[model samples]
Target: MNLAQRINAFQKLGIFFKQFSTAKIEKHSNSEINTLFFDAFKMQIERAQEFNGWFTKENVLKAFESWSEALSVENLIEWTSKYSFSKNTSPKTIAIIMAGNIPLVGFHDFLSVLITGNKALIKQSSNDKHFLPLIAKFLEHTNPYFKNKITFTDTVLTDFDAVIATGSNNTARYFEHYFGKYPSIIRQNRNSVAILTGKETEEELALLGEDIFQYFGLGCRSVSKLFVPKNYNFDMLFKAIYKFNNIINYKKYENNYDYNKAVYIMSLFNILENGFVMLKEDKSYASPIATVFYEFYDDFDNLLNKLNTEKSDIQCVVSNENVVDFVKFGQTQHPKLWNYADNVDTISFLLKL
Candidate 1:
């Protein structure tokens, strides 16, 4: 489609989403137009029925609502407008290795690459193979042209114009070795951390649960650590997040949580912490399994120095105020067409390309 046509289509997509109001959501009890979302709903429901743990209906609804709101035409256009790839500049083939930590985790990449008029060669994570296909099928119903551009595969990849891959630090070595020669965005192990100022309320603490347990702390965007003042009390925070105890298990996630928890507790000689994760004091960003440790600081100057020193390894930090001009976390992953993860400026990379 031409740029004008594409813009119009996106506008309609936004309106169509808005039309699926809360009343309609309750009345229909299923998403009809977006069969993909319905498929996700069914998958989640089946999981809940068969397994001990999964997201509640309320959490799933909130997640769906968040997706709908973020994918609205206004947000989509606003995010992508700055980097509307010119027909001449857009790559013809782009390889994307998606993360399966959260539901629809890599959707932003799929949407961005395709909307920018590039072919997406997606490698789905074994952890999450179902959701992307369902979404793609829904988009196919929305517009048939999407089918030719978005393809999922495990085949050997070569000759892509560009590449984007997210994986653990160990896997990152391999990704950089393989795709480094070309224009690429290789994301290694990155975790989001929260800075507690002791001024937050119970309501905000509950919202922070969204940042931590939304995807069961599986997504890279999930807050796996907290930075607080020295000797900060956990009474309020733990009490607030106690309601999400159900997030610790599902079918597959239970296995992960159990295995990781065992390994950590065994190594550290401790029992499972109250939540799905363990809290300890650490100087690093990543944590083992469901365990997220924290560090206490006495002063803002010390915090600033620590952040500056650790900036190279840090990806996103969720805070009430703008801690840094670049890093952000907590429901702000509505990336533009060109906003590469891990603070990699895509325009500069594209210019090199």
Candidate 2:
């Protein structure tokens, strides 16, 4: 298919996704395939929750809604506008090793490969095995040309020209060793942080709660750490985030809260809690599931320098007019199509391949 056909298929896929959010699913007259795929995809979404504990229905819908908003015709055209696709160049096979932390986590890479006229050999994480294949089927049905270009492997990946892998710091070393010879984009563990200037409104803090509690804080874009001014009062923070207390009702999250709280208590470490979430003073960027770490900043310039020096360890910085290139309160999860993961331009990388 040509570039216009590819874009149209994805735009339809986005519309298919829009029919599955938490809000009422409205049937659009323009969407013909919805009658064929809607009920089946809904069943898959329900099945996905059973397959992975963290893949709650609400979280899955949230992911779907985000993608629906992102894959507009305008977004697809703008995101691909920077690249030139030569009809003479043969398509290459790109193997994608996806992480299963959040729902449809590796879809951008999958979309990147396909949109750039390359084949995708995806090895999805066992924790998130169900959804992508069904979506791939939808894409194929939307545009038959995608059928030969997309493949999912349960066994070892082979016959690929390049690789895109996302994993922990440890797994990154393994990826580097195994795929070193090939052209690749191998990403390591990275966490997002919020910089609080002690001037945030209660509304902004509540939105920040969404940034923290969404997907149970499993996404790399989730804020795991915070930089606060000295002597910052967390009373407002706790109050604003109280709406998300229902998150603790999940047994898995409750277990984590109890276990982490116990560990802190036994170690006699000073930590704050609001029954659902825990706050501890830690310099580390990566926090445990039920906890978020906070560190005090004395000098703004020094804090900026430190964050710049450690950019590799950070996925996003959440703030309001406090830092350069910062994502606002609740927007870290709703990244635009052009907001590439790891700040690595996936489309640019694919165009080169």
Candidate 3:
């Protein structure tokens, strides 16, 4: 298919996604494919948590809503316009090793490979093995050209010109050792953090709660750490995020809270807790579930320098302050099509292959 046809198919897919949202499920169109796929998607949303405890129905719907907004015609055109798609270049097979920490987490890479006129060989994480195949069927039905362009594998990934792999630090090493010779983007663990200036309004902080609680804070974009000014009061932050207190009621989260809290007490750590989420003074960027690490910064300039120097370790810096490339509060989860993970342009990388 040509560029317009390709983009139109995804736009239609987005419309299909818009019908499934946490707020409500309503058919906005009479497209027959909706009859085939709508109830299927709803079943996936309902059964997702059974497949992976982290994939709650609410979280799955949120992913659907987010992608619906992201795949609009304007967004697809805007994101793809910057790239040069040479029709003469034969499509390469781009192998993608997906991370399943969040729903449809590997989708961007899958989308990128296909949009750049390449084939995708996907090895999905077992944590999230379900949804994508059905999506592939929907797309194939949307555009027959998509047929034979997508493949999912359970065994070794082979016969690909280049690879895009996302995993933890250890798995990344394995990827480099195996796929090092070929052109590749092998990503390791990276966490998001927020810088607090003590002047944030209650509204902003409450929205920040969304950033923390979404997907049970499993996404790499989830804010796991906080950088606050020295002697900053914690009460305001706690009060602002009280609306998300219900998150603790989830059994998995509550178990984590109890366990982590016990470990903290046994270790004689000075941690602060308000029933659900715990705040511990820690230098680490990656915090465990039910906890957010915090550090005190005496000088703003020094913090900026530290963050800039260690940019590779951070996925995003969320703040109201003007930090270059920083995301706004609560927006970490709502990244646009152009907000490339690890700031690496997947389209550019694919085009080079």
The model with the greatest lDDT is 3
Looking at model 2, residue 310 earns an lDDT score of 99
lDDT of 1 by residue, 116-135 (tens): 66678999887666556766
Query: RMSD of model 2, in Å?
Result: 1.4
For each of the candidates, give the backbone clash count: 3, 0, 0
What's the candidate order when arranged by decreasing TM-score? Answer: 3, 2, 1
The predicted structure with the larger lDDT, 1 or 2, is 2
Which model is ahead, 2 or 3, in terms of TM-score? 3
| Candidate 1 lDDT | 0.65
Residue 97, candidate 1: how far off, in angstroms? Answer: 1.6
lDDT (C-alpha) at residue 54 in model 3? 86
TM-score of each: 0.79, 0.97, 0.98
The lDDT, on a scale of 0 to 1, for candidate 2 is 0.91
Query: Lowest summed lDDT over 10 consecutive residues: which window, candidate 3?
Result: 83-92
The C-alpha lDDT values of all candidates are 0.65, 0.91, 0.93
Which is superior by TM-score, 1 or 2?
A: 2
- Record all residue pairs in model 2 with backbone atoms less than 3 Å apart, i.e. clashing: none
Q: Where does model 1 exceed 4 Å of error?
A: 7-63, 87-91, 248-277, 322-340, 345-353
